[model samples]
Target: MAADDIAGLIREAIPDAVVEITDLAGDGDHYAAKVISESFRGLSRVRQHQAVYAALGGRMGGVLHALQLTTAVPT
Candidate 1:
């Protein structure tokens, strides 16, 4: 999927999130993303990552490959 499509999935899952997806591997399968959301304000790093992963559904194991994720609570 395209970077915008990955970003769109995040937005669809978390309406308040600001997502930026990058093609780190340039393979359309591996990606890096930075996500900012109020929902992550108090969540731990792993929890935050889980939230984003969940947004991707089952793609993480199939269509969507490696994802290096960074998450933050918007200031």
Candidate 2:
């Protein structure tokens, strides 16, 4: 639930990704993550989000409650 935990999960899934996570609610549950990676180059926004969600390994709607995710390809 910590910011590092969220960033760690994303980094684990996308090894080359640059992850920046912010604790939105200061409660360790709500977060906002900005991910930049070459892997997301051709993926749609939804697909990118899905990838992030998958990276969480089913923790999206469970232990992690809310996440505002933004993904982009590295320029």
Candidate 3:
């Protein structure tokens, strides 16, 4: 799970998304992602996170270990 791959997945799912992924532990397994998109405008915080998770296509607990996620509607 490279940072670019994570970003790509998010972008694929949310075409207008701006995704930033950080390699937290300097390891491919741990990450922190900030996803911004207009698509999240009316969604709840939990739903916003879920959307991002869904974009990963079930890679969350498998190939990717831990992700600290932050999502927002673009300002």
Quantify all predictions' global Cα lDDT against the true fold: 0.92, 0.92, 0.94
All-Cα superposition RMSD per candidate: 0.9, 0.7, 0.6
Ranking by lDDT: 3, 2, 1
Clashing pairs for predicted structure model 3, backbone only: none
Model 2: per-residue Cα lDDT over 6-72, one tens digit each? 8999999999999999898898889999999899988899999999999999998789999998999
> Compared with the true structure, what per-residue lDDT tens digits does model 3 show for residues 12-71?
999999998889899799999999999999999999999999999999899999999999
lDDT of 1 at 20: 88
TM-score of each: 0.93, 0.95, 0.97
The list of candidate 3 runs beyond 4 A from truth reads none
Q: After the best TM-score superposition of candidate 1, give how far the Cα of residue 69 lies from its true spot, in angstroms.
A: 0.2
Report lDDT (Cα) of residue 39, candidate 1: 99
By TM-score, is 1 or 3 better? 3
How does model 2 fare in lDDT?
A: 0.92
Candidate 3 lDDT at 18 equals 91
- On a 0 to 100 scale, what is the lDDT of residue 70 in model 3? 94
In terms of TM-score, which candidate is strongest? 3
